[model samples]
Target: MATTKLTLSVDPEVIAKARRISKLRKTSVSAMFSRYIATLEESKQRETPLPPMTKRALALAAGTAPVPENWDYRDELKDILDERYGLK
Candidate 1:
């Protein structure tokens, strides 16, 4: 892969933590950041479902919820019309 050089800024505390971890693992801080970014990207690419919400949290959001039994989001837009101007 072609690599590009870039600069980034991070908190001093975070840099200190990364430096400690690198020292323990005998790796460079750049490698640690690269691995961290790669792991995050891999997780994003896998399309993993988000963690489940607590029942209390669910109940709180349900106050304004739109979903009812046997609701279909795809068909909800079929009868709606939108007009756009000055494009294309």
Candidate 2:
């Protein structure tokens, strides 16, 4: 791909730090900025899909579990709270 030069105004201290880091990494400052910009562009794309474990859990929960008849979660939660907190 063709590349275009971009002129940016940055703080002298920030440029100095970037120069030091790039020198230590044995890469040009422009190359470092290119990599950083590429990373930002990649992140702007769609996020990664859910992991395998999460996908499997969701699939198993979707109409696969047997729920007991007349099961009220509110009553169950109240009972649990009463037992734990000694509330009437």
Candidate 3:
């Protein structure tokens, strides 16, 4: 892949720390920043295609599992809140 050089302005203290870390790792600061950027890009690429709530709704619509006959979502939510707030 083609690479380009870029200039960055940073605090002297931060630059000094980065230089120390780079020396300890036996690599240049540029390589460290490159790896950091690659990691961020990889995380973005690996994101879920759908949000959890939407996925659950889709599964329910598709009848993946039967809803419980006595299920009360409001009561379930209140129970969850009570548990979370130590009210129960």
Cα RMSD to the true fold for all candidates: 17.2, 9.9, 10.4
Off by over 4 Å in 3: 52-88
Better of 1 and 2 by lDDT: 2
Ranking by lDDT: 3, 2, 1
Per-candidate TM vs. native?
Answer: 0.50, 0.52, 0.55
User: Candidate 3's residue-wise lDDT over 4-24, tens digit each?
Assistant: 899899999999999999999
Worst 10 residues of 1 by lDDT: 79-88
Residue-level lDDT tens digits of model 2 in 1-88:
6778989999999999999999999998988999998999999785889999999999989987677899999999999999999896
How many clashing pairs in candidate 2?
Answer: 0
Model 3: lDDT to the true structure: 0.94
lDDT of 2 at 66: 77
lDDT computed for candidate 2: 0.92
Model 1's number of clashes is 0
Alpha carbon deviation, residue 84, candidate 1 (Å): 53
Query: In candidate 1, how many Å is residue 11 off?
Result: 1.1
Per model, how many backbone clashes are there? 0, 0, 0
Best model number under TM-score:
3
